[model samples]
Target: MAELRPDSANRHRTRVKIVECAARLLRAQGAGAVTTRAVAQAAGMQAPTIYRFFEDKEALLDAVAEHVFATYVAGKSLADPSGDPVADLRAGWDTHIGFGLANAALFGLFADPGRGARSAATTAGLDVLRARVHRVAAAGRLRVPERRAVELLHAAGTGTVLTLLSVPPEHRDPGLADAMYDAVMRAVLTDVPTLPADDATAAAVAFRAVAPDLTVLSDAERALLSEWLGRAGTGGDRGQRDA
Candidate 1:
């Protein structure tokens, strides 16, 4: 391996120091408490030296977010890709929740909607999630409706973690958190039908000619038929259906 030059290595070390300091302060306190002076003091450097590495506080926060995301992705490499989708989903959920629990304040700041400069880091994390979804889907681990399933999984995981973090520490119950996570996993992954609505509809159309009595109607006909069925099932007439 080629050796890193002294000046280049020093610069890299300094940059890491600044980012580490920022991450520490933001995590211990909050983003609002992270100031240039505080970070410089934490890093044991002159305040002006920070400007040499980052242009402003926003830039520093963005760098910290990117660092946090990179560290998260680097640490989460499970070898069991051939597992059941529910198991894979549950594992992913645990990893996400563990990160949030470990880095509550840091994650809050990184995910804050006000942190516009950190959008790139957020997007990068989402890209990693999207790739994971594709991998699981290609392996037939994920159910159909790949994009929707992936999005719902992401939403459910994030929502559970956030809910856990929002509870006061004194009142929080880890059992409840586990319950919520399991509930979301069941609703999002386990019980979902293998044939998505779109695919099912396409299948219906493909078999329509063979079984016209099966009613492979277009959207308008489907809506009308649904209303009619509702009325007929309830012993109501066309007037009630129209109503």
Candidate 2:
């Protein structure tokens, strides 16, 4: 790799400093506190200097949210997966709840649909969730299609956190998060790792989980297999719901 030029290295460090300072302001004083002037003063730079690194206050705030959330995601991704995929999934849920509660301001920033849609860190977090769901499906524990399980878990987790955050801490139900998790798990998971022979949907889901890794299949074959399996899994889900 080519070495960074001196000017480029200094610019990078300056940008990092601005982001860190803005993040501190955001955590302590919320989004309203993270103005360009405030961040510039906090970082020991002129206000104009901030413009060199960020287009505007909105851009600076986005960077701050991404910086803090990326750190949390990095730590979360480093955890060793438990041998039991279900346990790992539960652990991930717990961690997500904890992170949201701890970083109320940052979490609220992400709660905004417009900002969240454009967030790279948010996408990375979902990628982690997708991987965990894949593991559960591969183990034959997922009753729903992997995509459905991931969406249910994500939606439930987000709603639970938002609900808890809306209430006063003193009045918040300590068990609410756990209850939501249990409900979502019931909707998505099988009781046992070994799926029933009659459960064609779950069998298709499990097969779909491992389809990409089947070396004997060509790329086109695996893609076609996955498409068929997805239809089977989702069709069963719809039928069950209708029943």
Residue 148 in model 1: lDDT: 51
- RMSD in angstroms, all models? 9.9, 2.8
Q: Write the per-residue lDDT of candidate 2 for residues 65-88, one digit (tens) a residue.
A: 899999888887888898999999
Q: Quick one: best lDDT, which candidate?
A: 2
Worst 10 residues of 1 by lDDT: 201-210
Candidate 1 residues 1-243, lDDT tens each? 888799989999999999999998888888886799999999999999999999999889888877877777655553455545446656766778788788887777655666733466566666656656555443333322334555676677667677778988787777865786666545434243233343332222222212324456677776656454434322454433332
TM values, all candidates: 0.67, 0.93
Candidate 1, superposed: residue stretches over 4 Å from native: 1-5, 78-82, 114-121, 135-144, 190-243
RMSD of 2: 2.8
